[model samples]
Target: MGFKKDFILLTKPYYCVNILLSLSYLLAKKAPGICVYLFTPKESECELDGRETEILFFLAIVVMIRTRKTGSVTMINYLTSSFIYTKIANLILWAYADYLYGVIFGVVFIITALVIPEPTYSGPEHVTYFRTEHALDDELESDKRIVWIIAFYTVWNPACVNFAPIFSELSAEYNLKNFRFGKVDVGRFPATGKKYHVSDSSLSRQLPTIILFKNGKEFLRRPCVDVKGKLQTFFFSKDNIKAAFILNTLYKESKENGITTDEKKQK
Candidate 1:
C-alpha cells in the first residue's frame, strides 16, 4: 500500500505533463500556421509574424513543467518515499519531454498493479500520531480493534511540552493490541480541537486534553477539574494516569483479549 501511494505520487508529474502537453497541442492546432511558423524562422513572412505568441507558448510550457516537478517532489517528500527512488524517478521524468496517451495508460496500469489498502500499525511500543484531522477521523471510523487514546495538544503550551515525554513513556509501557496512543497538535489542526471541544479560547484551559475513544465514539477525558473550572494539574502524571485509566480499563481489555504485559515483554 505504501508502495502504491509512492508510485502514484511519483508519477503525478508525468500526468500533469501529459495534460499540459494535450492543452498545448490543442492550442497549437487552433493556430497551426502561427505556432509552426514561430518554430521555423524561415517562415517569418507569414501574416502572424509576431514573436509574442511563440514566447508565450515557450513560457507556458516551462512554467507547467517547473510547477509539476515542484509539486511531485514536495508530495514524495511528504509521503517519506525512499530518497534513492525519488532521485532516480525525478531524473527519468525530468529527461522525458514528450507525452502520449499510450504512456499515460501505461502509468495507470502500473499504479493499479501496485495499489493496496494501507496496513495497520502492529508494533507494541510506538504510537502512531496523526498530522491531519481527516486522517484521524478516517482511522477512528474504520478501525475497531483498539481503544484510541488521543492527546490533543499545542506546541506553544508549556504544560503540553512538559507532558509530551510522559505521554511517550506511557505509550511505550502500556501499548497493546486493544489499546493504542495517538496525538494531534491543536495548533496545526484547530478544526480537530473544535470538533473535540478542546480549544475554544485563545488561551485554552484544555490545551493538553486527552480523550479516550472506542468504536469511533469518545468515552472519557483527562485533566479532571473543579466547579470553578480550574484544571487539576497534579492528576496529569504518568503513574496517576496509569492508575486512573490504563489499569482500570485498558488492562482489563487487554486481559480479556488474552494479551498480557508479560507476553509483550517476552516479545
Candidate 2:
C-alpha cells in the first residue's frame, strides 16, 4: 500500500523530488535497472523512470550552470518549489526514496539559498552623463542644454557599493536629451569633493552621493542637507528607500522647473 502511494507521489514535478532522485542515482553503486514500459498505441518502450531519475540527479549541476550564466531563480521561486515538494513528499509511502529525497533536497536547498550575487552598478534607464571636464563643458555649452545628475561615488563604503548600481539604473531611466547622468570617483578628485561639499563630517556615509547641477551651478545635493534640513531626515525612516530616491530627484526637478521658492521667500 505504501509502495503504491509513494509511486504515485513520485510522478509529480517538483524541484526537491527531482533533486533527491538525482542525488540517489548518483550515489548508487550499481547502475539502476534499464526497464522500459510501452504507453502508446504504437508499442515503443520508454525508459521514463530511469531517465527521470538521471535528469533529477543532474538538476543541481544544471542549476549551478544557470546561476553562473544567467542567475539563480529568485528566492521566491525557490520557496515555491520547496512548498510543492513538501506537499508531494507528505503523501509518499515508500520511505527510502522519500527519506533520501528529503536529505538531498535539503542540501541542494541550502546551497542555493546561501548563494549571493556580486554587486553591480546600473545607472538610470534613459539618462546619459559626461565623465570628463571637457565633455561636461561641451554638453553644457551645446544646444541640447542638458541637466547633469552626477553620481559621486567611492567603491569602499558598503552603502555606496549597494547604492551605486541602483543609482546607475535610475540615471539610465531618466537619461534623455534634456537631462543626463554621469558618475565620478570622489576619491580621484579631492578638489571636486571640496567643490561639491561631499565629505565625511556632513553628507553621506556612502561613496556615491547624487548632485544635480544646471549650467554648473549646484541646485540640489543628496545625502546632504541644505540650510532647511538634513537629507537623511527625508529618507531614513520607515525603510522608504524608493520614496527617498524619488523625492530627492523630484526636489531637484522642481527647483529646475522654477517651482522652488528661494530661502528668502521662506524666511
Candidate 3:
C-alpha cells in the first residue's frame, strides 16, 4: 500500500499536466469562438475581435498556473478544479452569448473529466538502502543472513554522480536474499559519514567509499589509503566491483552455504 501511494505521488503530476495541455489545445482549435467568450476576462474590458488565438494561448497558460499552484496533481483534483473554472467561465460566456453554448461547454468538460484515466501505481522491485546510521546499524545487526554492500557518497562530488548508474545496475543484477546493495548520501547525514570515516568537507579528498559488511562486521572496502596515508580513489566500474567483491567474496560465501548458482537461476 505504501509503494502504491509512492508510485501515484511520483507519476500523477506529469500525467495530469499532459492531459490538461492536450485538452486545452483541442478546445482552442475546435471552438475558437467559444474560447474567446469563455476565457476573455470581461467582454467590455477589452476588444478581442481579432485576437482569438492570443486569448486561447493565454487561457492555456492560466490553467497551467492554477494547476501548479494547487500542487495536488491527482486526476480527481485536476478534473474537479478544471470543471469549476470552466463552469465559471461558461457562465460568463452565457451572459454574453446563448444559454445553449454554456450547456455545450459543461457537457464537454464532463466528458473530458470522465475520459481521463487514474494514474497506475507500481512498486520498485529491487532492495533499497536506508539513509541514517541507526537504520543501517539495525539492519546489519538484526539480519545475520544479509550481507550488505553500502556506498557512502556526497552529492557535491561529481565522481559519485557518475558512478550512481553503475551502482544501481549492479544492485539489480546481483542482489539476492543474503546479498544486498545500498547507498548513503553523506551530504545529508554527516554523522553517518563520521561513523564510517567518510569526510564530508568539500576540500577533503576522499569520497564515494564502498564498504562490505557481513554478520554485522566490516568485511572489506574500496579506495584504500597509500603508504603516505593519503586516500586513493579507485575507478568504480561494474566489472571491477564484480571481480573484487561479488565473485571473490560473495560468491565464495554463497557456495560454502550451499546456495548454488542453479538454485539462484531458478529463483
Candidate 4:
C-alpha cells in the first residue's frame, strides 16, 4: 500500500504537495507542541537541509521526465547510475558510497544481461604462439592442456585485416575457460619464427599462416604457401575459410587415407 502510493506520487509530481501536507498534519497531531516541517513554498524558501532537499527534488524531476519519455524504467538507467556512483566513489575515496555503488553496479549488470545481446564468435579459439623462444616448451611444461592456432602474416599484406574479424569471432567462440589462444607475430617473435622456419625477409613472404597445437605438439599447421591461391580467391568468404579449417583440422586424416568408404557410398 505504501509502495503503491509512493509510485503514484512519483508519476504525478503535483501530488507531492498533498502527500507532504498530509504527513505534516499527522506529525502535528502526534506531537502538538513540536514544530513540523511542512512542504510549502519554492525550494529557495526552505531553511533546513535545503541542499539535500533540492537534490532529492531534482532527482524526482529527472525520474518523472525519464519515466514519461521511455514509458518504462530501463536497465540503462541503473547501469548509468551505477557507473556514475562507482566513478565518484573511486575518485573521492568514499567507502560508504563505494559500497553502495558496487551493489548498484552489480544489480545493473544483472538487469542489463536480461536485455543485452551476448557476443558471438566465428572460429577455433586457440592460435599458435610462434614468435617466442621456448614457447612450445612452456606449453609442454604446463599442467593444463592447451590449444594453439598461429596465424602467419607479413607486414606488407593488406588482406590480413579483412580476415582478422572472422578469425577473432572464431577465437571467441572456441576460447574455453581452460583452453587458451595466442598470437605469434612472426615478425616480432623471432624465435617462434625460427622454430617454425618462418622468415621475415621479403624472399620468404610468410603471411596468413595458421598452426594448431594440442598438448604442446603441433597437431596441424596451415602455411600461407599451401593455400596461397585459395586464400587469395576466397579470403573474405567466411564460409570458404571456415570450410578450409574443417578440411585441415577435421578431415586431414580422412584425406590422407584416400577415398573412404563413406565417400565410396556417396559416389
- RMSD for all candidates, in order, please: 15.4, 16.0, 13.4, 18.3
Residue range with the least summed lDDT across 10 consecutive positions in model 4: 88-97
Rank order (by lDDT, best first): 3, 1, 2, 4
Error of 2 at 119 (Å): 3.9
Error of 4 at 8 (Å): 44
Steric clash pairs (candidate 1): none
Question: Candidate 4, overall lDDT?
Answer: 0.45
Q: Least lDDT summed over 10 consecutive residues: which range in candidate 3? A: 117-126
Error of 4 at 266 (Å): 47
Ranking of models by TM-score:
3, 1, 2, 4
Better of 3 and 4 by TM-score: 3
Candidate 1 yields a Cα-based lDDT of 0.58
Query: Model 2 over residues 1-267: C-alpha lDDT tens digits?
Result: 145633544454443444454343333323233211112232233223554455444554544443322211333223323332332332231133346645655565455445523323322254444455355445555532346677776655434544454555565545554466767666655555656666633234534567766665566666666578654522221124336446456546644754223532543
| Runs in model 3 lying further than 4 Å from the true structure | 1-127, 246-249, 255-267
Q: Comparing 1 and 4 by TM-score, which wins?
A: 1
Q: Candidate 4 lDDT, tens digit per residue, 115-234?
A: 543222244444544455676567655633444555655544333433454566566655543344566566666667777766666544344456666656777655444444532212
Better of 1 and 2 by TM-score: 1
